[model samples]
Target: MTDNPAPAVVEPIPKWHEFMVPVLRVLSDGKPRTRRDSLTATLDEAGMTEEQRAVMLSSGQPKAENRIGWAMSDLTRAIAVAKPERGSFVITDLGKDLLQKNPYAITQEILRNIPAYRDYEPQRQNVSKADPVDIAVEDSELDPTEQIERGIQLLRADLATDLLKRLQERHPDFFEEAVVKLLLTMGYGGAENRGRRIGGSGDGGVDGVIDQDALGLDQIYIQAKRYAPDITVGREAFQSFVGALAGRGATRGVFITTSRFSAGAIEYAKSIPTRIILINGKQLTELMIRHGVGVQIAKTYTVAEIDEDFFE
Candidate 1:
């Protein structure tokens, strides 16, 4: 074989608008179709090549498939299709009537005309333009530049959820260490003020602590939990944590869990005299992901615009 191989030819992916009508048509019968079936139906009807199907996005999702997914999302937003179940969707009565009219192109203009889409307009910037069709093609909820940021935000959310699941699988000691590392990432401690994991050492209710200053005058106690979602942290846990802080003669504490806090738990934390910060499963993962404690940068892209100052 030659050292140089021919570059694989990449095929084009259709825009979101191109997939809208096909998605509507696939769901028009009112029979529930699964997510995979729906995407396949649209792509098949549109006659995309295998090369196009094989193309992958930076997020590892197929570009054409992602755009098709966006089309289905747009349809659901317009109430053109109803997702009555988790993975499957059915055409609503409104959707059926819409299919009967047979719009040549079920464009965003048609979608925005729906009352639900209009209801969201008050919060959006007032862009008084005569052409509704142009808004769909030209205007982005976030501009084209911002679309990159939006995609990265979505990717990070998926990664965070995965990291939380993995964290739950680890040992309690690991969880305590992860929280300390996360705190360090959040600027809680530096060379002068170091954090320590004390859970495995039979430390009291407190699992870890971060000395806030070099002199160690102030410290933040941590109580870490690797509980599942079904296991909610109740008020008792918070009260015990407060008692631990009292034992340490400390006023600041952080209660972190890989599960949600019960309503009573949240209330008790607020009512406690000590400063108790609650970090539930969702919040914990978000913080870790934000501070780069458990995750690493996969890729980076720099987007630049014309510097107005340079032009002046």
Candidate 2:
């Protein structure tokens, strides 16, 4: 008998824009409802599973409620929903017409076509006159917060690629020194930052060492290899490093490389008595960014919201 395949995992929640039509439909009866009541009704109309509804955002709000809130914000900007009284909302005639026209899905592009929405949208200064369609396409897909997060992720990815390329171009000694600095920045060298690169002709397989305390009783050895991105560090190299660690009577070591490790190398490291930590090119660059070793902050953005308690 053939074994049954595992069921595919369903997405826990829909995108903010996906909640637009449901929000409108919930208020289509033209009866005024509190924001909380409208959002609860919208969630019911969305037909989300209990597991899906249990998802929460980092801000402690339910994921479904946050997306529904954004959907309502967009619908309000488009003048499709009206606030007839404080904290209560009712669908406008425009919303009814939209529900009739877009029976299946209502998207940001559809909302953008409304003149009222365009008027309400914040105007940008010095927007490129060339390729206007690109701007529209960028705005139509994701809501504001999602767009910001996506943009930041793409920027970091590009920055990581450039950092790896530059590191590969420098001298092998530079790369060795960089790994030592990274370890110090990560707080591995204690508060005094006792770490040094010792890669030379007389040096053993280890390239760097970090003292975890002032007395240097507790120490961690490091082996850094500056290889091309396509090169893979193999088991033989790790065996040599492990032998060197044994010679130094050390139980912990870190092996960092600009390339990747062979599967055998990884397995061998895990099987050994000594603790071995491996850092590849991707991980190295990410650590550099996170600990602000080689990269510096270029810009900072601050987002603020109305203080509800202040009004009270």
Candidate 3:
């Protein structure tokens, strides 16, 4: 009889509440502690497993360590812990006073009751426990620079997805125009409108042509297929496209498709001597967003900070 396979290793995932008291204890000394030194010793003292200590979050930090950081943050908001010198911190009177009570538990309820933390309690309470990203995002807003950049990134990401969906719904001609506009905005075609749509029945897979310069002689061919999500352009399609390019004596081409290119098609393009840049639906939308092809700016915000050089 064959031996049974060993069971899968189950990594320890501790809830945030489990780390609260341990983090509080690490700062109970009332003396200032450097960021790195305290976190290193705190988790081990709390009896965290080696694997748990080593477990990384999506951001590549140890999960237990991340929770501990959040624990400190919550405590800091309540004035239980005070950050004195950049990453160094000390336990405040409020923190030591709390420890005098229920030294074992420093619950979220207790933290919010304090005046300093109460002001920000509503935003924290609004975050759903079901979504881990919610609180993390809320916490990331603590830094001025990170908050603004994070908001922009979230907006751009949503726009890219929405753009792709809208493109798939629009007319084929619209998609073609979008591809051309994106290239134009990227400075491929100059002020003379070097890109022209030539896609038709006898076009032999070539959809458009872009003049790298104002001159009409040198050309970069474009083959855009507004395919359904389920359709994947394969090697045979690439062979036909490359053949069409060769027929026109063109060595450079862009193959833009609403659907994906098959692995074989991508590999073939990589192996070929000719220059063929592939743009699938995802990348096409991303490029459009970057080049401002079809989207308009909705709102803009300007965040300002003190200019330290002005003080000098």
Per-residue lDDT of model 2, residues 1-312, tens digit only? 999998767576988888999998899999999999998899899998777777888867899998898788768767688776657889989999999999889886687688545433433334443322333466577788867775576456545655665687789999999999999989898889999999999788889999998998999999999887658999999999999999999999999998789999999998999999999887888899899988989989888999999999
Off by over 4 Å in 1: 1-141, 307-312
The alpha-carbon deviation from the true structure for residue 174 of candidate 2, after best TM-score superposition, in angstroms, is 1.0
Candidate 1 has its poorest 10 consecutive residues by lDDT at 116-125
State the lDDT of candidate 3 residue by residue for 1-312, as single tens digits. 999999667567666756667766877777788878778767866888786787787768888887777667667656677666567878888788887886787676666557545433333234563342443446556577766665465456545544555676778777777787778788877777788877777877788888977666878898888876557999999999999999988999999987789999999999999999998876787788777788988877776889999998
> Candidate 2, 311: how far from true, in Å?
2.9
lDDT (CA) per prediction? 0.76, 0.83, 0.74
TM-score winner between 1 and 3, please give it: 1
Q: Count the backbone clashes (under 3 Å) in each candidate.
A: 0, 0, 0
TM-score of 2: 0.55
- How does residue 18 of candidate 2 score in lDDT? 87
TM for candidate 3 is: 0.54
- Regarding TM-score, does 2 or 3 come out ahead? 2
Q: Which consecutive 10 residues in model 3 have the weakest lDDT in total?
A: 117-126
- Misplaced by over 4 Å in model 3 are 1-142, 308-312
Candidate 1 lDDT, 1-312, residue by residue in tens = 659988888767888778877887888767899999999998998888889999888879988899898777666655577656567877877777766775557766675677544422222235453434253443465677656655665466455545765787789989889999889878887765489899966688889999988878889999998995448899888889899899989999899998788899888777867898998877887788778887888887787889999999
